[model samples]
Target: MPLKMDAAALNAFLDQAFEQVADDFVVEDVATDRLTVRLEVSDKHLRPGGTVSGPTMFALADVGAYLMTLARIGPQALAVTTNCAIDFMHKPAARTDLLGEVRLLKLGKQLSVCDVLIYSKGQEPPVARASLTYAIPPQ
Candidate 1:
């Protein structure tokens, strides 16, 4: 299916629907098969070792999946994560933004499964990877 929302539309939707975290993430790119999101890292997102925290990475994955679903299905603010599996592979760079590259594995009427790879800006290898399933509310 073609995208129902683009980067600008998705960002606006985030601001209107989830104002609290709207500033933390930016929808960088929206394409037919993938969505790219950026997490603007701050001190609050860091851990003791000066690296991005696991929870921070997970949030990016979750939000990326949510936005990717919304891009195809239109703005569905009620869509919620039903399952998540994350792996922290490499430590992220300190004080660097993270990028989540999300791809939809399956997009059904009731659910969406997305795979996300998170990389610290300018890093070659992914710092973390996540698989997320979102439950789509009936329209």
Candidate 2:
């Protein structure tokens, strides 16, 4: 399906709909196969060991998946995550930004599934991987 929202549109939607964390994330690229989002790392995102917190990574995956779905289905702020499974593979680079690469695995009338790989900036291997299922609101 063709995209209903591009990176700019998605960013605008985030700003308007989720202003609380809008400044923390940036929609870097939007394409048919993938959407890339960057999380600006700050002290609040770090844990005691100077690594990115698991919750921060999960948030990136969730937001990335949500935006990926909205990119195809248009801005539906009510669409919510119904399920999420995440694996923390490696320690994230200290004080480095994280990038989430989202791939839509399935998009249907009621559900949208996405696979999200999180990586520290300049890293090759993924630091975490997440599978998320979103409940699409009825049209």
Candidate 3:
């Protein structure tokens, strides 16, 4: 599919949807092949050892994939995740920002696939990586 949405439009859509759903995440920046998203990690996002929680990382991956799909398909709000597999590679810092770098691997009529690599801000290595699949609802 051709590019139907730019970074600004994607950010606005995110603000209206997921951003409104929760204030912890913000769409920081996006490009034709990559998306930079940040999660304002807090105590609520942490697990027992002060590392970012798995669920939080999973949410980031999900939203990151959704944003990537919307960038190609335009503001199709009904597009939803159908499958996801996340790997927690390393522990993320406590109370720090988590940056998700998302790349859309495929976008078809009914399906979209993406890969997300998440890292804590100022950290050299990534904390998690995920592969996600989304179903694009027909209009």
Candidate 4:
């Protein structure tokens, strides 16, 4: 699929809504069929053991899938995450950025399902994976 919103446009749209959005997070790259989001590693995202917390990780997956859906379906700000299933496979390097690549698994009239893989930037394998579902408002 061709992208309606490019990396810059998508980032701008997200920035408009999430002013408090983490500086560590970025929509690094985007396409109609795929997107890459990054979380700039920061102290706010770390847990007691110096690892990224689950909530923080969830944010990455959520935003990644959320934006991909909006990118594909058009700017539907009303669209919200309905469900999220994430598995943390390993500890992320505190010094490296995290990346999330997401693709639409199912796009429906009222809902969208996305599969996301979160990786430590420059890593060959994902550090975590998530399947996110969003509820799209009626036209």
Candidate 5:
């Protein structure tokens, strides 16, 4: 299916609907079943050990999946996370941004599921992985 929204449109929707965090995330790429998002790291995202915090990584995965869903389903601000599971495999590099690669596992009428892999910018191995299920509100 053709995309309902592209990277620029998704980014604009994020800015208009969620201004507080809009700048933190960048919708890097979008396709039929996948998306790439980047999280610009800052001091607020770091933990005591200087690695990216768990919550920060979770946000990256969650946001990546959410945006990927919206890209195909249109800008649905009410689309909510019904479930999420995250695995932190390795310590993310300090001072590096995080990148999330999201792939749609399922997209039905009422729900969309996605798998996300997060990596530290410039790193090869994934630092975290997540599976998310989102509830799409009826139009």
Candidate 6:
């Protein structure tokens, strides 16, 4: 399927609708079934060990999946996460940004399933991997 929105449009939507954390995430690319997002690392996103927290990584995956769904389905704010499972594989590199690559596996009428892989910037192996299921709101 074709994309209903692109990176710039998604970014604008995020700015208007989710202003609170909009600055933390940037949509780097949007394609037919995938989206790339960057999480700008900051002190608040770090834990005591100088690594990005689990919650922060989860947020990146969740938001990346949500935005990827919206890229395909258009602006449906009510669409919400139904289930999420994540595996923290490696420790994230300290004081560096994180990158998320989200791919839509299934886009059905009532649900969307997405896979998110997160990596520390300039790293090859993924720091975390997540599977997210979103419940698409009724029209």
User: Which residue pairs overlap in candidate 2's backbone?
Assistant: none
User: What digit string (tens of lDDT, one per residue) describes model 2 on residues 3-103?
Assistant: 99999999999999999999999999999769999999999999998999999999999999999999999999999999999999999999999999999
TM-score of each: 0.98, 0.98, 0.90, 0.93, 0.98, 0.98
Best-to-worst order by lDDT is 2, 6, 1, 5, 3, 4
Per-residue alpha-carbon lDDT of model 3 for 1-139, expressed as tens digits? 5678776787778677766545776777776667888888878888898888899999999988988888888898899999999999988888788999999887789999999999999997999999999999996
Clashes of 3: 0
Question: Any residue pairs clashing in model 1, and if so which?
Answer: none
Model 4 misses residue 115 by how many Å?
Answer: 0.6
RMSD of each: 0.6, 0.6, 1.6, 1.4, 0.6, 0.6
Query: Any idea what lDDT model 2 has?
Result: 0.97
Least well predicted 10-residue stretch by lDDT in candidate 3? 17-26
Worst 10 residues of 5 by lDDT: 43-52
Q: What is the C-alpha lDDT of each candidate?
A: 0.96, 0.97, 0.85, 0.85, 0.95, 0.96
TM-score of 1: 0.98
Per-residue lDDT tens digits for candidate 6, residues 44-121, read 999999999999999999999999999999998889999999999999999999999999999999999999999999
List candidate 1 stretches off by more than 4 Å: none
The weakest ten consecutive residues by lDDT in model 4 span 16-25
What is the per-residue lDDT of model 4 for residues 1-139, given as tens digits with 9 covering 90 to 100?
5666777877888778777883557887887678899988888788887877888889999999989988877777889999999999988877677889998888889998999998888886788999999999998
CA lDDT, candidate 5, residue 127: 98
